[model samples]
Target: MQELSNRTSAFTDSVIRRMTRISDQYGAVNLSQGFPDFDPPKEILTRLAEVSMEGPHQYATTWGAQNFREALAHKQEHFSGMKINPNTEIVVTCGSTEAMMAAMMAITNPGDKVIIFSPFYENYGADTILSGAEPIYVPLIPPEFNFDANVLEAAFKQGAKALILCNPSNPCGKVFTRKELQIIADLAIKYDAYVITDEVYEHIVYEPYEHIYMATLPGMRERTITCSSLSKTYSITGWRLGYVIALERIIDRVKKVHDFLTVGAAAPLMEAAAVGLDFGDNYYKELQNHYTHMRNLFLKGLDDIGLKYITPQGAYYVMVDVSEFRCKNDIEFCEWLAKEVKVGAVPGSTFFKENVNHLIRLHFAKRDETLQLALDNLSEIHIKAKKR
Candidate 1:
């Protein structure tokens, strides 16, 4: 038999999902994957129920249902102060995963180089490889997760076609400040590169930290492609509703790639989620407050146990330094954590291009009781390490 395509030979299964399975096998508190354990908003759930009974089960337009796109445009405009033409500038996708993939395929030639920050979400690596783009890694140095302008510009100087920006970045939870974004925007303009933004955690920011849209920066509206999802914001990960917002020309190409990829997002799900897109400012405020509570709760637990961790400015994740435990391999440490400590975590090495193995990421997007339980289990890490 002939062998399969060689492109995927280097690909390994997702470390996050693998940790989740290990967590299940050991009956550990599963915080390895970044999905909420709580229910979605009642309004969205009610609308979904109604849509299930009603019609529109057939595919909507390949781009998106008209109403869903319109509602999304309004919500985006309300937050970002940028006007979007729903019919021309939007492509609703299976999730932000597909949205990012579609945008990569739309913009990249086989040999194009893309810039990605180290300690990034693991999917970005796979996305670049699948799109046939070589990736240039720029380090977002730890402790504060700040990037050096020179390092970033050097990546662009090597002829990067685009840079993937994860505002409220995963693994570390560093929210880019306005001044930092301005620097990136200026470089993007100087280098003649596009910016593909992953803003799924846009509305989950904590106090004193804001999520500034990179597209809103000067000279960026045309070149920035924003990819986001209702998964994190609306607690609807299973719905698989997400989209790409960009200029008409970019969306035109992305639409074709997206169509050939998944055909269209689920019709009924899109129709129902339109209700969530129309939610007023109050809903967002409440969402932020809820996340803040969870963050404080989890962090306080870590503090009480004298564990060291970086406090997130936005997003639901916290990176705990595990160097004190004297572990050299984070993957094995995480496996032991799940089985012995009864808590799951993703090895930080999986998300970094650098040789990092002293940290592991834990998420707080769970019910209060669940968070408490995980915290209770995590407090025993020192004892577990001693036994090992």
Candidate 2:
């Protein structure tokens, strides 16, 4: 029998979404995926209702809704300390997923090398493959999840055309310090390669550990492609709103790619979200405070449980050290954990190219009650693996 595309033979299904399914199978508390289990902002809902009644229900402008672009420019400039042109620097996309794909399509050619930090957000690997680019995996070594500057430079020396930077990173939750970002900027500048940054967690940072826009770094604005989303921020992951920002030249190319890929983000959703894009500073302050509370609650729980883990500086995830359990592999441990403990986690191997499996990632983007339930479930952990 003939098979499906061999291009995809190396890929398995998303472990994160698979965990969601497993949770369904067992009624487990799923901390595997990083999405909020709550309603989106009330204003966004209100605007969505109004948009549902009114009909621009058709396709928005191919690049984006004009209002959305304008709002995004304003918001980005305010945070980044760099003015962005609404007309030439932004493309609204389905999510950071599409924004990033558009970015890869815009800048990369087949066989180009793109550097990805290890234990990265999983989508990045698939993005590189499907975009026809080869990935150079650079180890952001564990515990503190810091990368050695010389090793990172080595990846660039190997003819990498771009690097995917995930600030306030997802699985490991390390916010690149300003000094660290400067070092990266210097490298990208020296290499003359593009910097594609995934900054969806821009506002989900903890106090005293702020997220720096890579594009805002000296000599980086024109060369950086920033992919960001409203998914995490507004608790509207399903709404699938995101955008790409670059210098006019890169945006010109990405807009063409995005046009063919998604033909613009959803029309009515984009229109409704323009209102959210303009939400006041208080909205962001409240967002940070809410995520801060969740971070504290979960990290404190891990501390009390005596779990060895990297304390996240930002983002909604924590990468825990599970070496004490004497696991054969992370996948087996995670499966045993789900069925036996009734709480799901993502095996750290899925995010790494190396043989390291001493880690597991969890999300705290749940309601307090839900958080408490998972914590309670984890409190009395006992796992003698059923299969291993």
For residues 71-161, what per-residue lDDT tens digits would candidate 1 score against the true structure?
A: 9999999999999999999999999999999999999999999999998999999999999999999999988999999999999999999
Q: Which stretches of candidate 2 lie over 4 Å from their true place?
A: 1-4, 383-388
Model 1 C-alpha lDDT versus the unseen true structure: 0.95
Error of 2 at 51 (Å): 1.2
In candidate 2 the C-alpha lDDT for residue 116 amounts to: 98
lDDT of each: 0.95, 0.89
TM-score of 1: 0.99
Clashing pairs in 1: none
Clashes per model (N, Cα, C within 3 A): 0, 0
